[model samples]
Target: MSRQIIKDFVYYFSKPLPFNLLRKLTGENFIFPFYHLVADNTPIHIKNLYPAISVEHFKNDLEFLLKNYHPATINDVLAFVENGKKSEKPLFFLSFDDGMRECYDVIFPILKQKGLQSAFFINPAFVDNKTLFYKHKISLIIEALKVTKENFLVSELMVFLDIFSANNKQIIETISRFKYSDTSKIDKIGKILKIDFESYLKKEKPYLTLSQVLEMQDNGFIIGSHSNDHPKFREISEFEMQNQLGQSFNYLNKNIHPQILSFAFPFSDINVPFSFFQFLDTKIKIELSFGTSGIKKDVLPKHIHRVPMEDNLKNATRIIRSEYAYFLLKSIFRKNTINRQ
Candidate 1:
């Protein structure tokens, strides 16, 4: 079975165990739960990518975390990591990626009502709806294909993707697999499908604007860089990786001027080298860096592994319990902590 399938099976079985019991067994008192966005209606840019949690589900997630884990601020997390600060209850730090408009429109208000703080990581390229992420462009093209009935266009798309015999589903699967390196192909697909991503950006205002980011910062929410543009760090060279971080950090310092320097890897931190963390510590002076490696410890003291709360649209209860269960399972094989090379 695939690793995900095994995780799902474990999650299914683990859900019946009480969360507190699972938590105690895992001996974990700190968690960083993160999401891309939250909305009642799925936006076209994100619909094909992953299911954005509904406002109601997000509220439930908050309620559960607040009940079981103390909501922690960025400073709290820093203290815990640096000084081994302990709380009576375990701590949970909330954060959102992608700087989606829903963060300003829907999410922040809800967080405010409950007196919670979170970090919002954004790509400098996509800020103020100036451009769309390439992945989001792929999503828009896929959505277009679903609604387009043009036979000639479909045939052209299949030819472009080099799968002339592909069915509609096959074509979408191909498009969905397009990586950051496939930007040219994604652009061509958008052209062929007549899906203008710029128009969508202008019309939808999908990402948070500079003004919105400023307001969010003023409201006690921390802001950080995801990158200059969201790219899979594993695919890029060391130089390109450093450039990405440098450019985004420059932008954040010049424009946002956040109190603390922080980052979350755009896609993940898998295969990232130990040297990179050293660079971040010495050159960037980043206060914190995060990865979506779920319920694990990292060898680098400053790097944190955050739980992705949106797995298969599961709630906090199931996801957290499953993470703990999976952590224990991995522990038996001595694979729980992340050791960078």
Candidate 2:
């Protein structure tokens, strides 16, 4: 059976029964769920790649969590780390990534209404509309391809990617594999597809401005660095990685006053060198960092793993239950550690 088939089987067959029993037996307590964006009307083409949800669904998610789990803040997690206080109820920390503009216009209002706190991790280069992430450029290009009957050399594009098929899912996956350092090629492809990111940035203003970030900070929300630009750590050299972290911290320090200096890895934190964190220690005091690898405990305690809520939105309860169940199973087999580097 395929992985998805197995995962679906686990999600459907065992959830809320065997899942609950496993959780109770294992004594797992906290979950951190993170998202990329929230929108009431997201384009269908980019939905899978970027993963956004409507305001109504987001509210439903929060209400579900509120009923089943205690919503915790970054401060609460830090306190747990420093003083080791465990919660009596299941705890959750909500986080958003990529610093999209919908965060300010759509998500913040809902969060305010619910009296909840969340952490927003941003790419400094995209904050002031200075530049856009290459992955987003891919999203726009794919959207353009859906509409226009343009005849372009998709095979030429495929040369840079590991993919062989030209299906939409594979296309997005291939686009996702584009190197951050060499975004010029994607930009060239965008130009050929008549999808201009500069125009999009000016017209739509899809990212949060510096003022919006400050307002979020003023309202007691947390802001953390994603990077200067969103790059995969494993693909870049140590010097480039340090520069990305340093420049991002410098930008956030100069603009926003976050109580804790925190960060969430862009793309992922897998295969990252141990020396990277040690280097960050010398430059800045990062209170916490996060990665998306479900409920696994990090060897570095400050580095927390957050579950991605984008997928399995239709069956939130079942999905979360299965994650806990899977955690218990992995713990038994000694396969729970997601990051050894």
Candidate 3:
């Protein structure tokens, strides 16, 4: 059977019976769930690449979570790590990543209406539309090329990017490789295709602005740093990792004055060095950090794992139930997989 079918089966079956029984028998634990963007519909320019949650579906997920779990903030998790204090009820913290502007528009209103709190983890470079992520640029260029069918020398692009591919899929694969370190080159390629990223930033305003972030903070939303630039943590050097941590936190400290310093890894923390957490704990005073690895435990208690809730097939409660069911099954096999460091 396909994994989705299995997960769906687990989701449905556990939702009605096994989940309730398991929770009553074993008790409930904390869950951290996250999303990237929540928009009414995916924008034409980036629809091919990223998935966005419709506002209606987002409301549904929130409503589901509110019904089954106690909503939490980063501050609450921070206190839990510091003093071993946890809520008596089943708790879940909601967070959004990459500092997308939609969080300000669609997400904030919904959160406010529900009287719940969430953390917005933003890249320092993206605030105020200073620069665009290369992944977004790739989509914009692809969209422009699809419209104009701009015929540039594919060979030249391959040579410039040092990639060995001749197909459209290869071209996208090559572009994805230039994520953090060499985005300027990607921007140059986009410019060659007559797709101006800066102009898009000026006009589209795809990212959160400083003032918008400040207003959200004032309205009881938590602002946490994702990074200075969103890069896969495993791909960067220790020095670069430290710099990302320092610069991002410093920017938030200077502007937001958040009570506690919190950060979420740009991508999954699969290959991140163990030393990085040491720096965060000892030198940086990081209260909380997050990863999107879905119902797992981290080496550091303060480093929380959040399930990605952007998948449309699963609602928040369904995702939680799946996690519990999967974890329970694994536990029966003498596998403590969820707490893998």
Candidate 3 structure quality by residue, lDDT tens digits, 193-267:
667777889998988999999999999888988989888888889899999989998898898898668889988
Model 3: lowest-lDDT 10 consecutive positions? 332-341
Where in model 2 is the C-alpha error above 4 Å?
1-5, 16-22, 43-45, 83-86, 152-176, 338-341
Using TM-score as the yardstick, the better of models 1 and 2 is: 1
Question: Would you estimate the TM-scores of all the predictions?
Answer: 0.96, 0.89, 0.88
Question: How many clashes does each candidate structure show, in the order listed?
Answer: 0, 0, 0
Task: Residues 1-341, candidate 1: write the lDDT tens digits.
Answer: 77677677788777778888888888788999999999999999999999989999999999999999888888898887786433446899999998899999999999989889999999999999998899999889888888898989999888787897778899999888889889988988888888888788999999999999999999999999898888899998878889999999989999999989999999899888788888888999999999998988877878888999988789998788878888888889999878887
Give the alpha-carbon lDDT of every model: 0.88, 0.77, 0.76
Cα lDDT for residue 74, candidate 2: 70
Q: Give lDDT for model 3.
A: 0.76
Which candidate should be chosen as best, given lDDT against the real structure? 1
- Models ranked on lDDT: 1, 2, 3
Q: How far is candidate 1 from the true structure (C-alpha RMSD, Å)?
A: 1.4
For candidate 3, the TM-score is: 0.88
